[model samples]
Target: MLAYRMRHRIQFQRRVQTQDPNTGEIIVSWETVLFSGRLDVPAEVLTGPGRELIAADAQQAETTARINCRWFPVDRLELYTWRILWDGRIFNITSAETDRTARQEWRLRCSDGLTDGQ
Candidate 1:
């Protein structure tokens, strides 16, 4: 990974659990965690919402980003367990690829999309 390009700090989490403070009840389901460290986002693809920001439609927008970070061992099945955390938004890790030749970094495709009424 390029040290200079590692300007953004990102964290990879597999699982997250949230609970209601008052009731002590589980508010969110449990999830696994990846790792955390500085990262380089050389490419960020933002597809427009395609229409005007009216009301509920804005929640259906989609955003994708290409992230590059230091190499880490991850199994194929574990891809479903990884999520990227940055800028207060959680980006799901859709896919992951490693640099076989150099073994230097991992190319990650992430997306932060929402469904209607969400």
Candidate 2:
């Protein structure tokens, strides 16, 4: 793994839901920092076929990033409840997978069009 290539710093945030003190209303917040480290975010390029597939589904485009496990040790549970913050942008993680042969890195499929407002 090219550790030097992980130049883009990113923050992993987990959504937490809690009840209000007096109002007794459930509030959503993202104050937990699960991990903070450098990542490699390459520009996404969709081919003709790939574009067609997305168009058919009416799905918004997404950006994928690769993170080194040495820098950020993320587990499966965290993957489902965490989102990434990079360069003032919020990215919702669609999937997180590690290589079967070498679990030193994690590929995160993310989307910028969606937010954790719900």
Candidate 3:
């Protein structure tokens, strides 16, 4: 892979659930940083009629992004539970894939949960 392609800086976060001792309430938090890396591939915004269809069916706008990182344990990632921060935008990890044999790179597919707004 071209190193120059990984120009966008991105951060991965995982949600953590904690209980308030006194209030007896469950707190949803995402303070855990699973990984901090660069995305060589730029993000692609979904638009036009296809985007409308996705919004109608999924109820949210989805943008696709590919993130590249060095080989790391795949267990560190939890699909659908991890969020990505890039350029002040938040994206949810839709899928992650890597070649077990190569074990040199990680490709992440992400979706920004919005239709028109970033």
Candidate 4:
């Protein structure tokens, strides 16, 4: 049997959203970057939060992207507040609410073209 060992001491999760700039439509391309301080590892993925934003027969106009990242502390042993980046803007979201739930899932949403309708 292979012994399982944690290669890195720390781990993190990052969620990102990409959208079209001109039409405000969601774009499926343009990979997002995610970093882990302790693990020194990075990964990228598509289809999150605003996945519904993508429509058939649609052409990307412009691009807007959002990223939500989280880091877990070794001592604290708890889910901490997360940071997010949206279209070159950075914001923070608290994990206070997560404590109340058994399982928590965070996501970043991107919407540029479609609106709620006036």
Candidate 3 ranges beyond 4 A from true positions: 32-50, 53-60, 76-80, 100-102, 114-118
Alpha-carbon error at 9 in model 1, in Å?
Answer: 0.5
lDDT of 3: 0.59
Counting clashing residue pairs in each candidate, in order, gives 8, 0, 3, 8
Candidate 1 wrongly placed segments (more than 4 Å): 16-59, 115-118
Candidate 2 residues 1-118, lDDT tens each? 5666666656667788899999999998886463333343322221122122254568755444434443246577677677766777676776777766545666666666434322
lDDT of 1 by residue, 67-107 (tens): 77777666756865667667676777777787776377877
lDDT tens digits by residue: candidate 3, 1-118: 5566656666666678899999999998776464434332232233223243354466554556666655566574454577767777787766777757658777666666572222
Report the poorest 10 consecutive residues by lDDT, candidate 1: 40-49
Full candidate order by lDDT, most accurate first: 1, 3, 2, 4
Candidate lDDT scores, in order, read 0.60, 0.57, 0.59, 0.31
What TM-score, to 2 decimals, does candidate 3 have?
0.68
What is the alpha-carbon lDDT of model 1 when measured against the actual structure? 0.60
Whole-structure CA lDDT of model 4: 0.31
TM-score of each: 0.61, 0.65, 0.68, 0.21
User: Candidate 3 at 8: error in angstroms?
Assistant: 1.0
